[model samples]
Target: MRHACFLTVGPARFRIGSDWRAPIDQLRALYSDYPMDEVVPDFTVRLQATSALRRFVRPQVAIAGDFTLPDAVPLPLHHGLLAAEMAMNLQMALGWRRHLLLHASAVSRQGRAVVMTGVSGAGKSTLSALLAERGWRFLGDEFVLLDPETGNIAPFPRPISLKNAAVAAMEHEIDDDSRFGPVLRDTPKGTIRHLRPRTEWIEQMARETRPGLLLFPRFGFPRAVRRMDEAESFVRLTQASTNYVALGERGFDALTGFVRSVPACAIDYATGDEGAELVERLWSETGAGAGDRAAAA
Candidate 1:
């Protein structure tokens, strides 16, 4: 490891060490708002070169960490920052026990949260980022932290990874150049850029919101909203959750309870404005009850 950085997101902390300084420098800049811990990190990510000569030649970043997939391939040196972020997420997905991790995006308004999950192109991240721009607190963009015991959604608002058209969508909303990272082309997810979560949101990470609603949002479709039955919602969530099976009975109880507790909706929208309108209407109609429950959760 040539350079290293340590930071914490929500309850999970990470220490990322890289053979090259550029990636570590980029990670440090992107997560500069976060505080480093003196205590041991929950997970460690090492971005090392495949061979000694590769360090000076076309460098490769091997994603070695505390928890990792065996078949994972090394990335080019230019993608070190992305590798670091992915490494951190990998650790939480494979190892964390404090919370039931959902591959979902979340946003909160006045302490009531909306957890949205779907397939890769679902646009949940875009929706959550758009909602945050319109005054909703951005809870998370990658994984939403759900405490199985308490059913409270803790804030895990890491930098939002925007892809393809999503980048232009955000550019239309936010004018802050500082929040937007460099637009890197020809990546695994097409053109990619990261949007740093607002400082106020990070400062208020201590506040936990109860899940008021569950959304399975799809973009590039006509405006439509459908309610999901408990059975349907449960099955969908089971597929979306990375550690539901590992958490065993506790995960089952929490997820089942969440399904029964919150209303579930599947919304289709062609644009961000339409998505925001639908979310506002739904929140107004049912957000109060959710807020009340969050206090107790």
Candidate 2:
């Protein structure tokens, strides 16, 4: 690979090498503020031609990196930023064991973190970004890193990936005009855009916050909030965590401690405003400064 870009996000460092220069340039521009002081990355991502003939024929980009799935497929070069982001996520999901990784979005305020995870189209990213815009400091939009030892969330704070309707949601909800990335079209998730988290989030990336609440968010539903029992929360978290099985006893202990330490809730909402108001009400009911675990499912 002739062109390369290196960046550090939270505790993970990445080196992205590209056969074509354009993708690397784009990554460099977006992650311009991330530190590059470390010479070696925790993981390396390679974006190269799919095949010998495919290289010159159609010019497709294949995401092959330090770690990859056997069924991994190549993507068009135009979506290289997405590929790079996916590659980094793959590394964290498959290789990271230093922390309990949850496919969640998170935000922090006053030493407490709100972690949200759910199935696709759950609007977790949009919700976390919205919370950041309001008052909470965005921890991350991709993977929420929970330290197995301390149970505190270490910020990943990467760009928020908004898909389809989410693009318009942020455009109308947030006032800042400069925090957005280019609108990419005709991709896996339809029209996609990247929104940079506020600068405060990045500056406080090293800061860790204790879990305040665990939320399973569902969008396009009537507004409701239900308590999730520890038993069910544990099962859901196992599915949410990519390296839970790999961590064995350590993973079990970390997860058990987490569920027992924090309260879990399943919330359904039709719009962002409703979701925000409901969460505020829930927080207030939890007794303000304390993190109160829901007593029953």
Against the hidden true structure, what lDDT does model 1 obtain?
Answer: 0.87
Residues 37-104 of candidate 1: C-alpha lDDT, one tens digit per residue = 65698998898888999998999888888998998888888888788877888898899888888999
Instruction: Find the candidate with the highest TM-score and give its number.
Output: 1
Against the reference, the lDDT scores of all candidates come to 0.87, 0.84
Candidate 2 TM-score, true structure as reference: 0.94
CA lDDT for candidate 2: 0.84
Give me candidate 1's TM-score against the actual structure.
0.95
- Candidate 1 clashing pairs, residues 3+ apart or interchain: none
Which candidate has the highest lDDT of all? Answer: 1
* lDDT (tens digit, per residue) of candidate 2 on 171-255: 9987777777777899888988888887777877888888888899998899989999999999999999999998888889889
Residue 69 C-alpha lDDT in model 1: 91
Q: What's model 1's lDDT at 230?
A: 99
Q: TM-scores across all candidates? A: 0.95, 0.94
